[model samples]
Target chain A: MEIKKTSLNKLHQSNNAKFVEFAGYEMPIQYSKGIIEEHKFTRSHSGIFDVSHMGQLFIYGDESLTEELEKIFPLDLKNLKQNCSKYSFLMNEDAGIYDDLIITKIEEGYLIILNAACKDKDFEILSNLLGSKFKMNLDNNRSLIAIQGPKSVEILNSIINGVDQLNFMTGNWFNSDNQKLFVTRSGYTGEDGFEISITNDKAEKFVENLIEKGAKLIGLGARDTLRLEAGLCLYGHELDINKTPVEANLRWAISKSRLSNGGFIGSKKIMNQMQDGASQIRVGIKPEGRLIAREKTKIFNDTDKQIGEITSGTFGPSVNGPIAMGYVDKEFSKVDTKILLEVRGKKHPANVCALPFYKKNYVKGVN
Target chain B: MSEVKFSKEHEWITLEGDVATIGITKHATEMLGDIVFAELPEKGSNVEKDGTAGVVESTKAASDVYTPVSGEVVDTNQAIVDDPSKINEDPEGAAWFFKLKMKDQSEMDSLMNKEEYDKFAKESAS
Candidate 1:
């Protein structure tokens, strides 16, 4: 199958970026500055990401629409105020996750953003569940551009006035230079940033403006390392249909009201599992040696018994060491607990560490 | 006089008498992007031509450095081990990985010349 190219493909090529196929899209993996430099740039300055491949879905209905969504998702949509965004999961009837998404409560309806690779499957699942009951629209013609870094606010403020007033996790309809945009102060990277949903036709021009303002274009390679350092979960790696939020260390995303209501799909199984405690819990691992603990590397106890497997691993630019996330037995999930990662038949010692290996410095405007 | 030979895996070897110094080609380092860490074989270890002698890890991926000629590892560049980015900065000169005592001088005949290896690197990139 032919891979899809984004509107910024030409720009990436002209800049001599190394391209790699990711999630069915031919995207830039890095540029001349390379992954380490790009990762550091986003942490210290500002970096722009071409995440246009991510799926954007809009749900519209009457007053009962929020309640209807709560039935399919595990989010307490009723309490999610308008213009606020919440991370939630769409689960199967058995409580296995279908996909994790960001649900933004808009003025007219709900805006759901899903992983690019799982877009088609998630659309089919939502259609099969809420086809006749609600109206759903997939905006495939739009593009998502994430401007991330500590200086993101300054860069965005120069382009769109009053955006600095918006707080984290809130979104607003933005009008700039005759272009309409849905601007949200949300990002996958654990930095202060904005994900701007723009029309495909206007994406190039918008990206050019940001680049002219000194926003370096980062690729998926840095994106992975950044999110991993922040201890954020990726869909296929840290989460799958069989894994619940409880096991993924995302219990905070589940609202207290929803826990008692038990009205959403998979709630019976998920709630029960929550009460009993999840058998496997996701934890961060920092290797003692320079050798990285790559994906599928088995974690073992001191006696050499298997405990878990690494889901994601890399030399985190921010942390300046090899960092990884894996699922281990609940009893072995304590911080500073020593474990061994078997890589290439050799055992490398590692320590269980806390989430967000790098402390995030999110920019907060003066209140 | 020293004669430099290239391996198909993009490693370069400079032979002076029976001593041979090895490192990844400048082209290979460019292709690998950023050099973060390297795993060098211990001095005195045996290595065979085209065999995995060491490992070079970039931020994005890891690659094995194969020996261009069979020999025993006599010395390693601890400077590169302490600062692997030297490979990215100067892949040909100061970034040589290790030194080996040549087992057979004729082994150099199996390697490519500088011009031939340059073309090979270009073709592989495209």
Candidate 2:
């Protein structure tokens, strides 16, 4: 099957982007500046990412859709305030995470933004649960662009108003003339940023305008490195159908109210993991040497006993060294613990570090 | 006088008397994209022709560097190991990966010269 193209596909080509097939879409892996340059630029200044392939669906109904949604996910959606977004998991009946999603409470019902690769299955899962009461509208016509860096607000504020006021995880639809833009102060890069949802016809122009204001166009390669540095979980890498939220260090997304009430799908197994502690936990690993211990590299302890394996690994431009994250035996999950990663048949010493390899610089609460 | 030869795997070997200097070709470096790390075989190690001698890692993935001929690793380039990006800068010269004392000079006859390698690279790309 031919790969699908986003609205800004032509723009990426014109900007000399190196295209790679990602999640069934012809996405840019990096521009002419390369991944290392793009990664560093996003950390220092700002970069624009075309994440339009992500699933953006709207579920609407007269009565709140929370009751129906609660049965499928692990979050208490009933109390989710309007315009506030909560990052939660779409869990299966057996407690495995189906997919991680962002559900923002809208005026009519809710809008769920999910992983691009899992969109089809996730859509089916949602439609099956609330199809009778809620009307699920898949928004394919809208393009999602993430503007991230210290200068993100300055770049975006020039085109629209009041976007700078939106706090992290809060979204508001801004209207100018006839075009409506939904801007959210949330991103994967662990930096101050905003994700703007715009219509297809205006998407290219929107990106061009941002470029004119000095936002470099970043691609999937830098996006992966940036998110990895931030300790954010990528769907296939850090999460899968077999891993529970507790194992992936995502218990924070499971609200206390939901845990106490005990009414969400997979609540039994999830609650059990929360109470008893998971056998394996995700931890960050910093390779002691220059060699990068990529995904699937085995992890070992001082005695050379196999402890775990790396799920995602890369040379972190900001960190100035190779970094990785993987699941390890909970007994060896403490920070600063010594570990060895076998890369290409050679063992390299590594240190277990705290998550969010880089400090988050989010602009919170109207800052 | 020196003569350069290419392997099917995109490694280049330059022969000068009994010693051969080896590194990945520019074509290989371009395909790998922004090489971040290089693992070279230790000095004095014996390597078989077409055997995996080292590894090159990019941000996206890792690839093995195969020896084009049987040889004893005489020296490894510590500079390229210290800064892998040097390979991207000058893959054929300053970024040379290692030096090997050739076991048999006749192996050069089986390798591709500059002209033949160019044609092979084009064919492989297409």
Best candidate per TM-score, number? 1
User: lDDT per residue, candidate 2, A276-309, as tens digits?
Assistant: 9999999999999787888899999999899998
Fnat for each predicted structure, in order: 0.78, 0.78
Per residue, candidate 1 scores C-alpha lDDT tens digits across A206-295 of: 888998998989989999999998889999998999888888888898888889979889899889888998999999999986778888
User: Residue-wise lDDT of candidate 2 within B1-126, one digit each (tens)?
Assistant: 477899999999988888999999999988888889899998999999999999998888899999998899999999998999999999998999989999899998999999999999999976
Clashes per model (N, Cα, C within 3 A): 0, 0
What ranges in model 1 sit over 4 Å off?
A363-367
Q: Which stretch of 10 consecutive residues in model 1 chain A shows the poorest summed lDDT?
A: A358-367
Residue runs of model 2 more than 4 Å from their true location after superposition:
none
Q: Which RMSD does model 1 reach against the true structure?
A: 1.2
